[model samples]
Target: MPWINDAFWQQLAIGIAGGLLGIIGALLAAQLSSRGKPKKELSYDLRIERALPEIGKELAPHVAIRYKDRPVPALYVVTCKVENTGNTVVKGQQIRFDLTPAHPVLETYFAPKPEPEWEIEELPETEETPGPNYRFGHLAPGRKITIKIILAAPEEPKVEVRDFNPTEHVPVLPRTSTARANVQVRARIAVALLLALLVIPQAFYALGSVGDIAAPVVQLGLVAALAPFAPSLIRALVHLLFRPAPRINLDRGIVMYDGEIRGVINFSGEPADVPDSAQTLE
Candidate 1:
């Protein structure tokens, strides 16, 4: 019988062993290849100068100031330096800076400015006279740029330079106390949609296999997905449909607080405060 042939059985056993060895060798080779590949390290530094006050209402083309000593009220100038140490060219957008009060006491007591004003200027004319306000648009590999900030301390106040940005600065949104609620509603809607997609498919499959009624399951799933998203979607639709252009009140000043002293501060131009809806998500 075929099953009783020793030579055939020996050949089968050898084939199986060879296949197993081949698989094991392939796995080892893959592991070795992965291990031999070196991870790339990023080589670029984009530091933003501390946000400082502009001299006046007249838009100054360059330079900004941040207060270092609030009690003595001394001005501190933070210079931002961007260096492209990597091998590739780096491109960036406008540079934005903000000075926020450090502590809760300062938030209540001191008068601080809202989001810092933005100065969009052309890039520096020469390497020697690199402009401070203007963003470095492109930096060739191994190139570096610097920006200077001049700080003016409040009268006999304690000041500290807290934060700066060029990379992924916090988004300044239109401020409304109800903004947080809107964000929460949006998030809930998104979650409900995801759940509907997952659960409805499983329910439909089960019902189909059992030959049971599936119409109710499908309807309920659709409703569940639509319920939470409906309100926000409707609001958006109305805004789009009516074309009632939203007005931005540029006159209002956003309040900022000092870290060392507790007080409300004012910025020159109207800066939108964080939306309340966003705060709720946090």
Candidate 2:
């Protein structure tokens, strides 16, 4: 039988240390590679143009007034501007507007012009909310387009905008072009080396100590062998419990094809005559 000598224990300690060191080095490389990767950002600029009176039937939807105007009574031309402010170009974008009238005073009092350009599809009469779905073409970086909607109302209507659609699993970002492939290769190598350190040394120790050590010692050796894998096991458990979810920034805007929104529009009008302010005829 082989002697359980001091050199045996020394080699075992060195093997455990080497395995731990390999694990640490692998983790550090993975973190560094992730940090060096470029970040991808999706952002846009959305602006609501002011209401302007139409010049005539020929230019029914066009508004000459570019400045913001107060919500008032009458037919007002409303324009919305959507701009791509990020590095990537946006394609096949669809935006939805939801309009809600203020109660008995304003309900059923709103009317919008019928035009295909406005893309305002009226939902069933039973539906309480009113608005339109507008389709926008591809927008290059730093590019913008204006959408016009003609609305007639006695008071301001509420409007809301919803653009973000959330999904699972965020896409992995790529490292810099020059180092991408090299980094990936190094990452795989590190992982493989770490696994070898964990498995090879444990096997050698178990085989060497066999028959020489008692049953309790063998159990202890098994525990020691598995201890090196605890970190990875814990990480796997954590990842299983809490997987990453995609983030959608509605206010910041998204690059998707379809979106929904709501807002309020007040029509320009004169308030009802108040007894206090009413002047009696002389």
Go through the candidates in order and give each one's C-alpha lDDT: 0.39, 0.43
Cα lDDT for residue 44, candidate 1: 23
Residue 122 in candidate 2, Cα distance off native in Å: 12
In Å, residue 228's CA in model 2 sits off its true spot by 54
Top candidate, metric TM-score: 2
What's the C-alpha lDDT at position 47 in model 1?
Answer: 30
Per-residue CA lDDT of model 1 for 1-282, tens digit only, reads 766587666655554444344334433443443334332111222233223343554654353432333332334444444344334444444443333332111111101211122222334334343223244445454554444444444422222222223564322222232344344445455554545545544544553432123434444545544565567756655554785433333223433222223346445754556665433220
The C-alpha stretches of model 2 lying farther than 4 A from their native spots are 1-73, 102-130, 164-282
- Report how far residue 182 has shifted in candidate 1, in Å: 6.2
Tens-place lDDT per residue, model 2, 67-103, is 2353334444445554444345444454555555522
lDDT, residue 135, model 1: 48
TM-score of 1: 0.23
